[model samples]
Target chain A: MSTLIDILLLSLMGITALAAVRMKSLFGAVMLTGIFSLLSALWFLILDAVDVSFTEAAVGAGISTVLMLGTLSLTKSEEKTSNHSQIIPLFVVFVTGGVLIYGTLDMPDFADPLAPIHTHVAPHYIEKSGAEIGVPNIVTSVLASYRGFDTLGEVTVIFTAGVGVLLLLGIGRRREDGDE
Target chain B: MTHHFILRVITKLLIPLILLFALYVQFHGDFGPGGGFQAGVIIAAALVLYALVFGLNTASAVIKEWVLLVLIPLGVLIYAGVGVASLLLGGNYLDYNVLAHDPVHGQHLGILLVELGVGMTVAAVLTTIFFAFAGRGHRDANGNLLPHSALSDEIRNRKDGQP
Candidate 1:
């Protein structure tokens, strides 16, 4: 049953991706992209990467959709494809996909406790994080304390994006000017 | 548009619960899956819902643009301030262990402050972005910009009689 479900989910994801990329209407493409993100999030959840799934759902399905829609609002909704061919993009996609698939072949079986990641620093952190940080969530402990600098960098990136948006929109303008 | 009976009743019931859930998520991060970021988004989404029902202008009146502007920087400052405090307390930057006499207590205090900052900045910025997008003119049912007056008078006249 689980295998069947997984196969169905994978097929759906493939269809969504194709639809998202191939749609001629930019608005439809953008919305399909959001659906693709949402389906990917569901896949991540099924794969038991709950934290990653949450991030994907929020950032990919939510924020990226909003950002794309905002961009669409500023531009034409219809995509005009002319005599220009997509040969280069197709080649690039094929090569990238092949490389990724080849790389995955060497990976440990899914959810294997004997996986290198589980045996290495992960066990140490899992065993020691409660004592060291007193936090129940090992992910949060690692994010906020052990690799604190990386999380700080992520926060800075978010802050920078906020600043970029404000700068592009202009900050001091009154709403009466219709620029707010 | 005037308030519908269902919307008015639903908003009154749901808004408070949403606000409460946001606060709970914000404070419960230490124990659960949610954190400042999720809480902030939830809160902002609630406001967005309110705006969708009550109109953007009303929501803006409640939140105010200036307040949001101040909030964005204030959140950044609050977050950075914790790091500075740690530095002053004889630790490296953002070493939350130094925030209090007891290292564990200090860590707790620092996390709280930082989370508060994160929540503030996220909520403010998300709402601001929504406001900017929602206020824009788009083609209406008749395929003309909703506020036709914003266009030139000649252009408006040309398009008016046709559709």
Candidate 2:
């Protein structure tokens, strides 16, 4: 049953990807991407990465769809037709994809208990976190307790991104330009 | 879609629920399958939806741009402040074990504070990005700039693009 679901979701994702690529209208393409993200989130759920699935659903499917729509509104609806050849970009993408897959070949299987990553600190986290942190969700304990420094860095990166956007555009017209 | 009555009504009904859900995701994250990052995006998405149905002006009125700017850094401060607090408590940087008489309770307290920080920063930043993008004036034919509130029908109805 799980295998069937995986096949169905993966096929749908492939269809969505193809639709987005073949779509001439940028609006349609953006919507297709949103659908793609939703499918990805569902796939993540099936993989037992519930926390990851939640983040993907909210951030990838929900927020990114809105952001992409905002971006699409700023530009032309129809994708501009270009005489430039697509072969070079296509070749580059293919090469990159091939290299990524090749790199993954050396990695452990999905959720392999004996994998180096699992053999490492994960065992400690799974074992000791309950007694040490006392949090029902180990992911939370791991993220906020065991690796608080990394989360601090992530927050700083988010802070920097917001500041950069402020410098570039600023939050709208500051409510004083008399323009709604 | 200012005149979109159904959308307007639906948005009015949905915004509170969305916001409540965001908060739930934020506070309930420690026990559930969510956290600051997910919750933050959910909160921003609620405001974005409001802006979409009602208008950016109304949405910004609810959450002023300056407030977001202040929160952007304030969240980082809150997160780092916890670390500093832990440090002052005679633990290493971000070390929660020494935060209280009991290490587990300290972990709980530290995790909540830091997650709050993360949620705040993520929510503010995403909303600011939405405001920046949607706040820009749309360009029309003949190289004339049309204010966002008055985007030309041609662009507004372009295969039902975002309004």
Candidate 3:
């Protein structure tokens, strides 16, 4: 039953992706991309990755859509037609996608008990996180406790990104006496 | 946007709820499917929605740009401060085990503080970026700097025979 739902969701995602690429209006493309994010969030929910799905829904669908619309407003709504051919890029994409699919063929089946991922340190974390972190959500424990440094690094990266945006957009002033 | 009565009313009703939900996600992250990153973006989105409906100047008035600038670095400082505190207490960097009398409680405290830092930085940065993007290219009737698209909306409202 879940597989059928997954298939339906995947097909819809593909349709949205295609629509986004095909649209000439950047606004429509941006909206389609938001829909694509929503579909992918649903896909993540079906995969039982609630945290990932939540992040996708909030960041991907919400913030990114607004950002893209802001970008569209700053520039042209319609995409300019390029004179160059798209054949080489299409060929490269196909080759890269094919290689990725071929690479995945060596991996274990979905949810296999003996999969390397299950047999790895995941089991140790799952078994010990409850006792060690005392948190109901092991994901939080793993992200914030076991991998605290990594999360700090991620936060710093976000901080840097914010600075970068401010720098690029010329909004780095500390006072209110400058141009908007 | 102010000219659109329905949009203004609906946004006024929705903004508080969105902000409340963002706070819930931020605090309840340890127990649920959310954390600082998601909560930060959610809150930023709420602010952006307010900017969209009420105009950027009003939003900026509510949250001064300088405040966001200070918050961007303050959050990083808080996160790093936790690490320094842990180190000073004879633990390694970011080691929450030594933060309190009990390791479990210490971990909880550390996680909450770090997540708060993350949330602060993310929200400040996103809001700042949105401001930059929306602030540019703002023009008045004679090509002077006005409050971006809100000027055009006001003109449209005036044209429609409304005060």
Candidate 3 chain B weakest lDDT stretch, 10 residues? B137-146
Candidate 1 per-residue C-alpha lDDT over A51-134 given as tens digits, one digit per residue, 9 for 90 to 100? 567656766676667767777877889988877777998899999999999999999997788999888788889898777677
Best by lDDT: 3
Tens digit per residue, CA lDDT, model 3, A1-180: 977888899999999999999999999999999999999999998888998998899888988898989988888899988889999999999999999999999989976889998888899889999889888788888988899889989988988888888777656353233233
Clashes of each: 0, 0, 0
Window of ten residues with lowest summed lDDT in model 2 chain A? A171-180
- What TM value does model 1 have? 0.82
Ranking by DockQ: 3, 2, 1
Which whole-number lDDT from 0 to 100 does residue B129 have in model 2?
Answer: 88
Count residue pairs with overlapping backbones in model 2. Answer: 0
Query: What are the per-candidate TM-scores when only chain A is compared?
Result: 0.84, 0.87, 0.92
- State the DockQ, from 0 to 1, for candidate 2: 0.44
Docking level for model 1: acceptable
What lDDT score is found at residue A108 in candidate 1?
Answer: 98
Of the pair 2 and 3, which is ahead by lDDT? 3
TM, every model:
0.82, 0.86, 0.90
Pairs in clash, predicted candidate 2: none
Residue-wise C-alpha lDDT for candidate 2, range B1-163, written one tens digit per residue: 5488888888889889999988988899889877888889889888888878767667777887778878888889999999899889898999888877899888888888989999999999999888878776543433233456567665557537544
